[model samples]
Target: MADQRLERLIRQLQRHTVVGLDTAVFIYHFEAHPRYLPLTRVALSRIQQGHQQGVTSTITLMELTVRPCQLGRRAVAYHYEALLVNFPNLLLVEIDRSVARRGAQLRARFRVRPAEALQVAAALTHGASAFLTNDHGLARLNPIIDIIQLDD
Candidate 1:
């Protein structure tokens, strides 16, 4: 937790040329998680301002929309979908064959779920400096791309 302070994260965000978003980032933002929303919003604003590039896989949209769609909250689902699609300076990486192939390898090696593997693969494929997430487990995973744990 000491290592994951907000101030240090902001500096790291400034230093990294590119970072990837995981579905949790959107989930926190949309669900207004008290612990994570502030930093997530600030980082995203910085990205939108062109401070650094942000990228995520199309799988993110699928993940983000699930609960809302399941609850018949079409507006909320649409909101999530639209936000991911139109975020400024954010690149939505498609799950092409190359990404799928890489994800398959990641799945075999890391035992991560297919969607999670795809997300990591997409970030790596896009040359992101780090993959930003709140998943504490991923912090220890030693991915090819840096995994910045927002929750420490």
Candidate 2:
């Protein structure tokens, strides 16, 4: 069943040229979260192989590094930073004015948090046709960009 689900996810991802990734997806993948690892592994592999372009906001970088930094795991934090910076076909986007404006609009319209709104805004700004996330609440953004929830 897991394999079948992963296959379905791959198919869905293959249909898009670019996919937006949320921070939770990376955390699950890095930490090897049992339920989500398979989904994130396949999705990240596709992005790494350049089969799909991947995008995420700088907020993801900030979010990913905080726990490690707080725990005095600077090496681990550096590793993550390097991985994100050098990852192939993955663009770590900065929060620019346009993205901020769009994010504000999304936050107002969807009542999502600022960070969540910025993440979606970055993806949409960068032309991502699909956003891969573990947050089910983000499914509300399906009208603007296809939201692929890992749990689904």
Who wins the lDDT comparison?
A: 2
Cα deviation of 4, candidate 1, in Å: 7.4
Off by over 4 Å in 1: 1-4, 140-143
The per-model lDDT (C-alpha) reads: 0.84, 0.93
- What range of 10 consecutive residues in model 2 has the weakest lDDT sum? 143-152
Tens digits of per-residue lDDT, candidate 1, 3-41, equal: 357787797787788898999988898888888888788
Model 1 alpha-carbon miss at residue 150, Å: 0.9
At residue 67, candidate 1 shows an lDDT of 94
Model 1: per-residue Cα lDDT at residue 63: 87
